[model samples]
Target: MSESFELADADRLTVGTVGPPGHRVFYLQAGEAGRTITLKVEKQQVAVLSQAIAELLADLRAPEAIAAAGELLEPVDPLWAVGGMQIAYDQDDDRLILVAQELLAEEDADEDDAAVGRLRFTREQAAALVARGEELVEAGRPPCPWCGYPLDPAGHSCPRTNGHRPPTP
Candidate 1:
């Protein structure tokens, strides 16, 4: 009952974001024949996807795929927001396949308005996406020294402080 879309040979495929480093929204975008499809995604999803792609590529018989610098990631209006995400390797085609399900409210779980999409990308394209993901993740708030939690602009309340003033060092 849900809608579906597939981009088998996307001319452009990459993970992108909107807004500043700490307040950004992640998205997965694919383009072909002047048309583009965008799906909302979580930052953690991007990180996982990037690592998954890298690992999958490493296991392939093909040579390692390294992302070239300065690749451009264009923006697109999300056709549908995404919730669950999945990835697979298509050995026959030598492609990385990604699938995303539309974001749904708890009450709407049984509704038929859900959207599902599949995108296939070459090793090169997948590697490029991973590179961008790494950059975006690192651009966020820096981690605290005492604890590994990310430091907010106002600073994190380090548990190691035991309610005392956080160590300056």
Candidate 2:
């Protein structure tokens, strides 16, 4: 059975990437006390998660100023790749809850065998995560103006052009 973590009142929760631009690998990390849990995630996941968190925060009172998040901690090893994720607000505790489920293999017999992680953090942390997520995403390769796909540093063959002309700069 895979290990799961419940980081209630986590001290740190953030998203970070490894490698350069087009070859980047994104990760979702949460830590409490001395324990840190890292999960592999996709670039699109980070972008969508940031948008969702921004919308959620907008519906409630704004959070106070938060300290800028630092770079990813050393030994960034992910326990599992994230498959599905969920976010919700806990009015009673006045905290944001993020739950990430491990990606299961196709041949796995029991769906319940997949590990799950739950992180409860304050609005400040959530806001910081949103900010960092947006920054990381924007730092990557620019998107194609026509097709909305990532434009390769070398060159891109945008489908919108039907290969009749070069990709839009």
Candidate 3:
């Protein structure tokens, strides 16, 4: 049988890693009408992400939620130590946001390991993230990857950077 999860009011959840560990970091955001509360942290993996969400859901309020997420994600992910959190936003309105920390799974105990995990995204959430990406692209922003710098195959120079090599054909 196929399983299903219903994410009610998905605008209340934003998940991702913060930055390098050794510091308190995690990000969470909850939107209302359109805007949301957002949080950022250092390094958090799937397992840690799960716990952080659970805690945030329980808190309901904004600050506590962010604090919990930050605490959980305070440590860097041993494997993919570089990741950050971002919450979707709708420019038409404003809303409350939250942030939190998280922990990883047992299988990912080492700093150089990979683990498979599962997450459920509601239709609205999926669409929102996608739309956000599209908006970025429309704004002359490059799609996500390679140090936040947009990649241009036309040998274009980047005003935000210098002395960079273009992707190899």
- Judged by TM-score, which candidate is best? 2
Q: Is candidate 2 or candidate 3 better by TM-score?
A: 2
User: Model 1 over residues 1-169: C-alpha lDDT tens digits?
Assistant: 4457988887788777788766788888887777778787888888888888778877877546555423335545678788877889888998888888888888888646778898887888877887888887788778778877777776568888875886453
Best candidate per lDDT, number?
Answer: 2
- Model 1, residue 33: distance off in Å is 1.4
Off by over 4 Å in 1: 1-3, 63-75, 111-113, 159-163, 167-169
lDDT per residue as tens, model 2, 1-169: 5788899999988899999899999999989999988999999999999999899999978898876666788799999999889999999998999999888888874769989999999999999999999999999998899998999888889899988898767
TM-scores of all predicted structures: 0.82, 0.93, 0.24
Better of 2 and 3 by lDDT: 2
Instruction: State the lDDT of candidate 3 residue by residue for 16-52, as single tens digits.
Output: 4343322224333334444343333232233344444
- Alpha carbon RMSD to native, model 3: 14.4
lDDT of 1 at 107: 82
Better of 1 and 2 by lDDT: 2
Candidate 3 ranges beyond 4 A from true positions: 1-28, 32-36, 40-121, 141-169
Question: lDDT of all the models against the reference?
Answer: 0.77, 0.90, 0.34
